[model samples]
Every structure is written in structure tokens, then in C-alpha cells.
Target: MANAQLKEEIIAYSKRIGIDKIGFAAADPFVSFKNRLLEQQQLGFESGFEKGSIEERTNPSTLLPEAKTIISIALAYPSKLKNAPKSKKGDRRGIFCRASWGEDYHHILRRKLQALEEFILTKVEDAKCLSMVDTGELSDRAVAERAGIGWSGKNCAIITPEFGSYVYLGEMITTISIPPDTPIEDQCGTCNKCVEACPTGALVQGGQLDSNKCIAFLTQTKDMLGERYRKKIGNRLYGCDTCQVVCPENKGKDFHHHPEMEPDPDIVKPQLIPLLTISNKEFKRKFGRISGSWRGKKPIQRNAIIALAHYKEKEALPTLFHLLESDPRPVIRGTAAWAIGEFTEKSCEEKLIQAKNREKDPNVLYEIDKALKNKEFDKIQG
Candidate 1:
């Protein structure tokens, strides 16, 4: 009875602290999730960024010995950018996905989870709790699913009825045994929108994702993007929302409940060329607060190179030449070599030839070779 009263008080406190949705679940082992994760590993589909081993991820008890209940929270973020800057022909802008639009969700969710944890301690002195956001050993999606926070959608995102898939999920495991809430019913019946709209068909089927083909995962990778996916990524600087953007459930689901969750028009969609020359300190100062910047500026810059190439912006030729000649990163130099070829200019050949002499990395050399071949091919076609 006392625990039941504590649950109500905790829920009230959660709302006051700005948690959009809260749910409770038993701290039982996530049997199905473990099986799914093992299957993903077997198929080489798991994202390498996943935290902890399979054993540690699936069992909440391993994380907290006295754990009895898992408290799940979701904070809704804005789906639309207000007064977003346009990407014109010459001045193309790269975009970070809606999830990366605002303040790093990890920080936002952690604060809310901590508040709930404190409230729990206030009621139960001996109460023990462990909280984590996306980085924790426990799967935030699995905990949210079990706690009735939302249903796992076809895009492999937890889709809340209120916030669609635009909500950030986090959880807490507590010694206080609150009764578990029933899981939400799956509403993805007969919906194949997200799967079909996937750029690389990364959403193989339903909830299964091949991380290698996932543009969101690809965007975070520091190395060169695969040649086939180069054009497919378009101007995405960080993360891909193609799957979520195409979901029918997310239709007209824009939410602006939190100020910090709102996007800065200039930051989320910055000019592509400026990003190429942005210094390390400047990049951090501008992008440090957002989740997309977690992978650092390299991947974003690499994507910007790809975006510039996709645009075939003749204006970017000088910047591309500079990157090929001086950038320390092989991916940047290689991608710039490719981007230079995209521009049909006489100096492109000479610039690439100059870079070829200086370039030592086999991959960069190979890209330069490919670029030259493409130019030759274009000449033959012309």
C-alpha cells in the first residue's frame, strides 16, 4: 500500500520535473530482447556503439542486485525546426536529424532520471537505484517497451502515442518494487512506410536493422562512407531520420513541449562549405551541446564533403582542393578528391594530380584514382 502511494507521488514528481511520460515495469530479465540482440549479433547487424556485453545489457539484476522495478521515462523533442535555413544551389547546408537538433538528450534525460531517483530516496530511505540514459548497460528501448512507455516501431524506434518516435527514452532500476505497467500495444499493423523509405534498405524488415547500411550509423563513422551510400546520404551531417520521417504515425506529430529541445535553425542546418574550414575549437564551441557532435567533427566534415560532391558546387572546389592537399585525415582527403572530380573544371585534374603526388594512404590514393577514372569517363561521355 505504501509502495502504491509512493508510485503516485513519483509520477507526480516526474511530471513536475519535466519528464514527458513515465512508466514502471518489473526488473525481470529481458528474455526476448536478449534473444533478439544475439540474433542481431549472429547476423552482424548490431551497431558497434552498443554498450556492454549481451549478458549485462539484458539483465537489469546484474546492474543492480536489489533491483525490483524499472522506471522508464520519455522526453518529447521537436520534430520540426522553426524558421530553418534553406539550402540553395551554391550554399548547401547539411542537416543534423531531429534527434540531434537541440541539447544532448543524454544530459536532459539524466537530469529527469536523477530527480526521480532523489524523490524515490526521499520516500524510502533504504531505497537503492541505478539510472542510465542511452549509454547505460541496460537497453533504454527494452526498458521503455516493458514499462508501457511506447511500442517499438518498424524503424526500430520506440514510438510513443503522444510523441511518435520523437521522444528520448531513459530508465531507472530501483529496489522499491512498484507494480509493473502493461506494455503498449503495437500500432504498426500493416505499416511498411519506414522500411520502404529507408535509403539503403537498412531496415531489413520490421524492427530488424543492418547497422552497416543504416545511414544514421554510417554518419557517425569516422572512416570514409561506402561509395554506393555516398550519394544516398545526401546532406545529412549527423544521423538519418528517413525512416522516422516516413512513418505514418509521426504524421503531424510536431511537439514543442521543451524549450531546450527546440532546434537552433542555424546550428542544425549550417552551411556546408563553412563546416569544411571550421577549426577544432570553433566546431566544439558551436556543436558541443548537441548530440550529433558526439562523434566529433570528422564524420560531420566527411559528410559535408559528400554533400558538397552531391551538389557538384563549383564554388566548393577551392575548399575541396585545400582538404585534399592539407587535411590530415585520410577520409577527408579521399572524399575531397572524389568531390573535386564531381566539379567539371579544368583545374580539377591538375589539383587531383598534385594531391596524388602528396597522398600516401592507399585508400586516399585509390579514391584519387577513382576520381580520375570518373573524370575520364565523363570526358568520354561528353
Candidate 2:
């Protein structure tokens, strides 16, 4: 069986199995990508969630011995929520990014890759294959770009012609040789919308990111969010979509090919206040399946507190006070204290002072002190 014929069979089979797009590339060291990653590391721009060392990430052969061809797959997810719920005055809602709207994409893309791996195995019994999704050692965007699946967008996403930048990417490194597809020409010529619109200026420039300043990365951390980014976070409970939302290439590019990728409006954009007191079991039952929940309920809850602060939803003050006084997690308590301070209520001073007295955690104490002395409140009242 010729490799070209097998590649054709694989493509046909991929369509049957719901892979939106597929492309092939020669497995080679990503020299340019390695240099960029080294720069990212030197500048402390990595998100810490990255899984592998530069050598392991840039060289596909290191992952799989004798790797010859790489197969990259893209699955398009819905960008627009159908019949989305509204975030009203007292019942404001926090949102998960489009990437986390539905079921976890890692599972969805991995399943597709597994099916492709099985199909490849059947064709060539001696063929060796290794598959991975977003968390893999190799960069999904780099592989997808090399495979002609998409051009690497300035937003650091693989922008496919068919689905724009709203596609989930995965890849398989194979021992068998296959004719590779032509790499897509860079189509994001002179358009700087994504970089310009990054809320935290996380996009340092086109095609470069400072992960420390990225809202998407900050929202997933377990500790207290920087005071500067709290208001910038807005109502995002998990992840950030500012760059993607602002991309010209992604204009009106919503796709809903897979039913599993469709978002539940309520789950993806739930009311913010209830999230403050949600139990771990309830959080798991409601959001456990989604990728945004990977860091667990702490970050989401912390972000929800910040969201309430952003809205200045005075109705949330009671809940915020309760969390400040009683929440076991320091991140939650500290964030809640900050949210309470946003109200600038004279009544909150005693509560903040009391919390300050009891708070053992230095971070929580600082937040309480900031809340107590809320200079904006004093300046306005004076």
C-alpha cells in the first residue's frame, strides 16, 4: 500500500469521523519555534502550564523514534452561543471563553486523533503512531501551521481558511512517510486588531505574547489575581477571548459541525453570585467536563469575585462579606475582600477590620487592609 493512497484513505476516514480539517507535514525540528520559545523563557513569558522542555517540544523525533510524517487535525467549535442568557442587574453572569463553552475540547480532539491512529494502524500494521492534543509536548499551532492546516495567526492561534481561528488543533507523529501538504501562506497581513485589542496588552506585538499579562493565563492561577488585572478581567470566569473576538479573520466564522461542541448557555455563562458559594461537588457536577474547570473551582470562584467587583453589583456585597469572613481558601477570601471594597460602603469598614484582625495569611491581610482604607471611598466621602 502506497503512502499517498493511505493518506487519501486517512483523509476520507477523518471526514467520516468528524474531523473538520486535516493536513500532513514532514516531522522535523521546529528550529524557529525553539528560538521563540527560548526567548519566551528568557523573558518569563511562559504560562507555567506548558508541559515540556524546549528540546522535547521543538523536536518531534525526540517524542517518537523514527518519526517521519505528522498529521495535524482541526475541529471547529461554535463561537456564538445560541439563545444565550442575559446578565441582568442583580443576576450578572460570568463567562467562559468560547474554547471552554462546551465539553472539554481536549477529550473531543483526542478521541478524533485516537480514531485516526486506529485507522492508520489497520492500513499498515507495522506503522507506529503517537497522538496528542493541546497539552502535548509539541506545539499544536506549530504542527498545524507546518501541516498547512492554517496560518499561525498574530493572536498565536492556528487560523484555518475554513473555520478561521476558531478551530481546536491536535496532531499525530507517525513513523510512516507521507507526502506533506503545502504550508499555508501567512494571510494575516498588516491586520493588528487582535494585538491592539488584548485587554491586558498580553499580545506584546504581532505573533508574540507575554503570558504573565494574558487574562487567559491569569484567570487559571490559584493565587490572588494582581489588583491591576482584577478590573481588566471583567466578567470572565475562565479564559479570555479578547484577541480572538477582535480578529478580522474570525469575523462571522462561527461553526457548529459537532453537536458535542455546542455550548450550554447557562453553564458557560452562569450567574456570578451563586458561584461564590457553590460547593466543590456542585462545581464539579456543573463544570467538571469543561476545559476551563481544569484548575478546579478556586480560580473560577476567585474570578467570579472579581467579576462581581467589576459590575459593582451592590447585591453581591453580602455574599462577598460572607466569603471574606468564612471562605477557607485565601484566594477566595482575599478576592472577596477586594470586591467588598469596590462598593465603598462605610458599613464594610468594620467587617474589613474584623477580617484583618482574624486573617493569618499575609496576602489576605493585605487585601483586608486595602479594603479597609479604600482611599477612593474616603476621597469621595470626604
Candidate 3:
């Protein structure tokens, strides 16, 4: 098959398989990506992942040595939650930001990409194909931009004119050569809404994204919160979407209701009390496949306590009380003490003092005292 014919066939099949958009890009390595990665490494922005991961990311040859073209695909996440559930009492505001409102995108994207890969091999018997959802050395966003599917916004997300930034990107690295599409011009012109709206200043001036301050990255970190970054966490329990939400391009993209991807009403905006009370077995059963599962139950539990503390709802006092004395994780216990201190009145102060005496962990005691000090409970008791 000719390159043009192959491109047309793949695009047709992609749309048939539920991808909203598909485009082709020449498998040229990203030229400036290496330098950016090096800069991030030196600045201590690279997380637990090794610095070598970045080099592998910039080298298309490492991903697919024989690749001549990249096939980029995007699926639009439902922008509106037509059946939006009520936020629990004392719940913090904010939706799941579409991309994460439903079943895991990785599972959905991979199954579809693998199907596309199978379809391609039937057309070109000897062709080699590799599929990746966000889990490859090659950058899906860069490939999508190069393929003219979208332009990279200052927030480092590829934004389609039709779907805005509410699309999930996937890619196929293949030996099959295809006619590459022309790149799109940057359409984000002079707009700084995404940058200015960032709660943690993660998106520093212009298009530079410092992952160190990124809420999305922080959400995926392990049990311990970094000292400097914890104060900026706000009430976010999972990924952050302030940039995408504030983008003018994403305006009016609300109320998407795809049945296949719809979030479980119970799971969407879950009650903090339930999270604090859930056992590890239940946690595995509930969140095993979601991106939030990467760090296991402990971090999610810890984050729930932090969010509860920030909410400062007196209603959450009972939940915090139960967690303070019995939670297995010391981090969760400490934060629960802090939450109790923040919300419970002097009426609850005696109970807190009793809990503080029984609390074996030093961190929990420290936070208890800190919370009491902040509330002037020490002066009252004195």
C-alpha cells in the first residue's frame, strides 16, 4: 500500500474504533526534548524515575528503531457529567476534570490501540507495530502536535480546536511509512489564564512546566509529603486541573456524559469519611486499576486526612476521632490529629488531650499540639 493509502486507512479505522481524531507524523526524534530533560534533571525536578528515562523519551530510535511514522490518536473525554453526583457534606469543590471522571484511560486506550495495531498488520502483513497509551518512551503530546492533530499549549497539553484540551492522547510507533501531516501553529496566543490560575505556580512563565510544583505529580508521590510542597496541596486528593479548567480554549466544554466512561456516582467526589474508614482490601477492590492506585492506599488515605483538615468541618470531627486512635498509618494518624485540632471546639479539646496522651507517634502529638496552639486551646486550658 502507498503511504497516502495507509494513512487514509488508519484514520478511517481509528475513527471506526471510537478515536475522535487521528493524524500522522514523521518519526523524527524530538530535537529540543533532551535539553529540556537535562535542565529538569539539574534543577532536581526529576522524581523517583531515573534521569535516563528522559533520554529514552527523546530518542524515537529507542522506542522503535525501524519507525518511519507515528500514528497519533485522541479520544475526547466527556466534558460534562450529566449525572453529576452531589458533593458530600463538607466536601471540597472541583470535578474530576474529565480525563479521570470514569474508567482508567490507560486500559481503554490500550485496548483500542492494540485493536488498531491488529488491523494494520492485516493490511500490511510484515509491518511492525507498537502501541502506547501514556506509557512509552515517545512523547504522545509531541507526536500529536507534530501530526497537526493539535498544538501544545503553555500547560504542556496538546489542545485540539474541537475538543480543546479535553482529549486523551495515544500513539503507535510503526515500521509502516505514512504521509506525515503538517504541524499546526501555536494557537495559545498571549493567553496566560492557565499560568495565572495555577494554585502552586507549577506553570511558570510562558510554556515552561516545573513538575516539582505540579499538583498532578504531587498526587502521585509516595506516602511522605515534601515539606515545601505540602502547603500548596490545597484540598486536591488526586490530579490537579487548574490550568486546563482556566484555559479559555476549554470554556463551554462541560456536561459530557459518555456511558462507557462515566464515573461511578459513589466514586465521584467520594466522602472523606468512607476513605478514612476503608480497609486495604476494599481499597484494592475499588481503585486497583485507576491511576490513583500507583501509590497504593496509604497515600490516598493520607491525602484524605489532609483534605479533611483543610475543610475544617466540625462534622468531620467524629471521622477524625476514629482515625486518630485506630488508623494504621502514622501519617494518616498525624493528619487526623491536625484535622481534629482544626475543627473540633474546646468541647472536643478534652477528647483531643486524651487522644494526644494515648497517641504513640511523635508526629501525631506534635501536630496535635500545633493544632491546639493555633486554636488557643493551650491558653484556655492553662
User: Whose lDDT is higher: candidate 1's or candidate 3's?
Assistant: 1
Q: Tens-digit lDDT track for model 3 on 1-382? A: 7878877888888878888888888887787767876776787766554323775677766777788888888888866655556655666432233566677888888988999999999999998888887867677788899999899999889989888998889999898888889888999999988889888888877677788678887776665565456656666668887888888898987534345676665564566767878887898787665565667777777777677666665677777788777877778777777666665377657767887788888877887777666646766666
Give a tens-digit lDDT track for model 2, residues 136-157.
8999999999999999999989
What TM-score quantifies how close candidate 1 is to the native fold?
A: 0.98
* Cα TM-score per model: 0.98, 0.98, 0.90
Identify the runs in model 2 with alpha carbons over 4 angstroms from their true place: 379-381
Rate residue 99 of model 1 by lDDT.
92
> What overall lDDT, based on C-alpha atoms, would model 1 receive against the true structure?
0.91
Q: List per-prediction Cα lDDT, in the order shown.
A: 0.91, 0.91, 0.75
Over the stretch 1-382, how does candidate 1's per-residue lDDT look in tens digits? Answer: 4778888998999889898899999999999999999999999998799988999999989999978999999998898888988899888899999999889999988888888888788789898999999999998889999999999998999999888999899999998999789999999999899999999989999999999999999999988888999999999999999988898889999989888888888999999999999999999999999999998999999999999888888788888899999988898999998888777787898888888888889999999998888755478458
Candidate 1 residue pairs in backbone clash: none
Q: Model 2 Cα RMSD, Å?
A: 1.0
Best-to-worst order by lDDT is 2, 1, 3
Better model by TM-score, 2 or 3? Answer: 2
How large is the C-alpha RMSD of every model relative to the true structure?
A: 1.3, 1.0, 2.6
Q: In candidate 1, what residue range of length 10 has the lowest lDDT sum?
A: 373-382
